[model samples]
Target: MSEENKKGKNDQFGELVKSMNQFFHDKPVKGFLQTMDEFFRAPFPFQSAFPVEVRESKDEHIITAQLPGVKREQIQLDILDNYVTITVQSHELFTEEDDHQRPVRRRQSMQRSSRTIPLPQPIAENKVKASYQNGLLQIRVPKQKGKKILIEGND
Candidate 1:
């Protein structure tokens, strides 16, 4: 009687393990899909919506910012001892008009835009120049030279 009871308990434990394994096997694809969805939904904070470029040379540092539909008056430039700042502001405009033949109203929209950039190195104050052309803003900041110090000891 004791041997029969032990055999019955082992069979029950085996059945429980088999049922748990089947549950996991039936939903394997769901588990994998959920993992992939989480991975793709991760946020990217470092990405920029527009493009910009910066270049440096022996004489000066150059910065070119793209502003497709922006105007010259919408931008500002600020310079300091070791850095330069550029700021652009955006404005919006809306228009509505009625056609003579159809009497239908049409709507149009526009957005104002702005951006700023800070230079890595200080530039020569007197030699800085800036200009805008063909929707591109360019700045040339001349490099400043450092003065050398001479020390002499008493003879």
Candidate 2:
């Protein structure tokens, strides 16, 4: 082909690549892939994000979880009957600098992680308590008691 034709074809190919990139970046599918990418990039996709342990006593159940680099306000704990759910939302700030030592782009990203665990016995929601110290989160839930039934003796 002629040089003019080659140049035109190259320009068209460049435009096509740019359009594809933009489409991929602005699509909801990209958002989903990004979410999955974030999940897979965590310390351990299945466990390390919020490693939790449950211990049960005669009167109560104790739960402990480790959340490194997270703030106390970022943690939310929910108790529903015998199940305990914990959610943590964290934010990270990223800055891109130019050669002149000036920031060219700045962005803040948020990640949310949640885990639900079942207790050995049903718990009393009114008596549940939770506390966070350092990077450790601890929760105490009082076990629900069943009332004994009294039966009348027949003659």
Candidate 3:
């Protein structure tokens, strides 16, 4: 075989390996591996991002978030200036006993996640109400009323 043909074969092999690496690191395969690791590594906490929506009404601003597997007590909401922050903290504990009545395996995991959203306008922080039910967190805050300004145009 000629030297050029050997070089071409080597380059092709390198390109193939690079493409395979890229494919494995891409979203689909990487996400599956992360999910499986989270399931098997009970001693390690896994944090995942959820979805949130903010809506505006005539009188109030409503914020909704989906938080499956999260308890109401694990969630915390805070409003500062025009920004609202949501935080969730969770802990799981598991233990297994042996035939001799001694503890064999014990696992504990703690996870925390937080998200912050800025409102389009200021709100009445003191009047904010929040509720969590059916794995959904909803927050309602009254919008602050702004004074109207009138401008006169010269003819």
Identify the candidate with maximal lDDT. 3
Candidate 2 minimal-lDDT segment of 10 residues: 40-49
TM-score of each predicted structure versus truth? 0.49, 0.62, 0.67
Model 1: CA > 4 A from native: 1-49, 97-116, 149-155
Lowest lDDT 10-residue stretch of candidate 3: 41-50
Native-to-model Cα distance after best TM-score fit, residue 22 in candidate 2, in Å: 22
TM-score winner = 3
**Residue by residue across 29-106, what tens digits does model 2's lDDT show?**
686677678667873423435788888888878899998767898888887868899999767787768899998667
Tell me the tens digit of each residue's lDDT in model 1 across 1-155.
69899999999999999987777667566566655675578532122234568898987788888766667887777777676666665544434344655533343333333345566666676788999988888888776676989988897
User: What lDDT, from 0 to 1, does candidate 1 have?
Assistant: 0.66
Steric clashes per prediction:
5, 0, 0
Clashing pairs in 2: none
Ranking by TM-score: 3, 2, 1
User: For candidate 3, lDDT tens digit of each residue in 53-139?
Assistant: 999899988999998878889998988889999999888787768799898566676788888989977666889999899999999
Q: Of 2 and 3, which scores higher on lDDT?
A: 3
